[model samples]
Target: MNGLIGKKIGMTSIFDAAGRNVACTVVELGPCVVTQVKTEETDGYQALQIGFGEAKEKNTTQAQIGHFDKANTTPKKRVIEFRDFNAVEKAAGDTITVDEVFAEGDTINAIGLSKGKGFQGVVKRHGFAGVNDATHGQHNRQRAPGSIGAASYPARVFKGMRMAGRDGGRRVKVKNLKVIKVFAEKNLLLVRGAIPGHKGAYVILEK
Candidate 1:
């Protein structure tokens, strides 16, 4: 699969040729530099490791700076590798622009870390139904998971129980999304429907 590294640049609605409104996510696509190329003879597989975004000189470590030097590019904020890329001929220090890989109405997939929701309850996270009474004897069982396990059979809470703790901040992939528009000059990619993570968050666009 061919992929590009981009930033989620919020969302907006636009009118299509059919005069219908379409919701789209605006992404700042890449002019990613191919930093390293892994060949089967050497690294055991063929892959293109690319780098994107700009990082401050002092913020990145010396080792990362040196890796960017191999590509003759500036310090990048993040580095990602794409396996078995054959969409376009690429090389080390070569720039892969977003326009070459994506087109309007093309089906693509997006991967990103979801926004953190802190600690969540079972009702919100696991979709459990709480107690349903206020007048009987229950005082506050609105958002509770009543019984976890049986008394004699199990004796203790079973493993893999649907209990809520920390939620979100996990990698999520949104698939089969249609590319609404591509602004090649601006390196902007607009896609239909909602994507993972928050605005300005780093996202991987795969086709």
Candidate 2:
């Protein structure tokens, strides 16, 4: 259940050994440092906390500095906990590269926040079909919900009714995405198909 935190470097098409055009999402992955190790006896769990992305030393607080000192690594912008230590046998200040986490054809789940679309209607958000009349006395209610409730039965609008409202901007997990390739030298991971979130957003890659 080990995972790595990385930034989405957008996506591109690349050819495999067979010369097939493979759709992929390029990610700038690890080189994340092992910050803290939780043990079974003390923390009641076995896990290693890794830090990624460097933050300016001037902006980092004293408490953060002390924490990084324990691992002998410079201040990081973000820190994520990964369960299980035996996966990499990582130590404090040790960098975890993409090669150590995933390989080609490895099945993984990419978790990230989807891009916000800002107040979308049900037709676009939840895929609800709208009124099919473009004419025939129809004016501007084409995108409106035709009916909401029963007349003399329920007498109230039912809960969980799909309506036009705020949309997107939520954590989405794309499961079973195959890892097409791994560029360890550039810390890049090319995954097949589209993933959630906008470019440069932080994404969690889990296997």
Candidate 3:
């Protein structure tokens, strides 16, 4: 798998050749530095570890500083390892740019953490139509989960039942999103449709 670590900038619309405004999510891809190359003989797996963004030395641990020092780069804010990265052979300290790998119109998958909505109800979280009819003595059940268990038989709620709990803040992968544009100089990529997470969230763009 060929991929890069990037950050979600925001959403914007651009005019296509058909003169229609198409929505695109803007992302700032790397300038990633190769931090380590794990070989099967050494680590029992083949993977390429890359780093992006800058991190303060004070905030970075000594082990991390030594790791980056070996790579001839400073402390990186984001470090990701791609397993079975067989697109091209790269050594530690090498840099990968956005334009060198991706282009316009390519289909890619974006993986990110979705926005966190703390505790929620079944009506909002699980899309339950809670107490829609206000008349028949249903006053406080406007957003209730409504019957959870059976009176007899198992007499217990199933384990996998969709009830109210934590919503969002999960690793979400949006697949088959087309690449709208790629600006190599600015290290920006505009992809079609909305991706997971809020602005400035880290995303993994996989092709």
Candidate 4:
């Protein structure tokens, strides 16, 4: 899949040609630099390693500096590799813009880290419906996970049982999102509907 590294700028609504309001998520896509190019004969596979965003030199290691030096670019905050990108001809030190890869109405897949919701209960985490009402002896167990295991038959809770714990902050992929608009001048891509991650979080758009 050929794609670009971008940041989830925010979300907003836009009026379509039918004059209907549609919600969309705004993403600041690449202008990424080709840091390394892998070939089948040389590296056993083909892939394009691109770099995005800027990082301070002082915060980067000497080896990393040399790696970026080969591409004739400064330190980058985000580096990702895309395998089998046949859309454009590229080499080390090449620059890839969003317009060159995507257009309006194109369907794309977005991969990103979902927002972290610390420790959560079953109701919010697993969507387990609690006691229907607080009428019959159900005082404080409304949001609790009723029964976990059998008393003496199993003697212990089964593994992989849904329970209250840490939630979110994991890799998530949202597929089939339509590209409502593309702003080449600003390197912004307006994708229809919501995507994973919070504002400013890095996301990968694949076609």
Top candidate when judged by TM-score against the true structure: 4
Span of ten consecutive residues with least summed lDDT in model 3: 81-90
For all predictions, the C-alpha RMSD in Å is 1.6, 2.0, 1.7, 1.1
Show model 2 residue runs off by greater than 4 Å.
16-20, 152-154
Taking all chains together, each candidate's TM-score versus the true structure is 0.93, 0.90, 0.92, 0.96
Candidate 3 residue lDDT tens string, 1-207: 789999999999989989999999999999888999999899999999999889999999999999999989999999999899876789999999898778998999999999999989998899999888889898888888888888888988889998989999999999999998899999999999999999999999989
Instruction: Write down the lDDT of every candidate, Cα atoms only.
Output: 0.91, 0.88, 0.92, 0.95
Shift in Å, residue 184, candidate 2: 1.4
Range of the 10 consecutive residues with the lowest summed lDDT in candidate 4: 130-139
In angstroms, the error of model 2 at 123 is 0.8
Return the lDDT, model 2, position 60.
Answer: 97
Which digits, one per residue and each the tens of the lDDT, describe model 2 over residues 1-207? Answer: 778889998989988889899888989998788888888998999998988898999999999999999999999988988777566787777889889989998999999999999998878988876787888888887777778889988799888988888999999999999988788999999999988999999888888
- Could you say which candidate leads in lDDT? 4
Candidate 3 Cα RMSD after full superposition onto the native fold (Å): 1.7
81, model 1: CA deviation in Å? 0.6
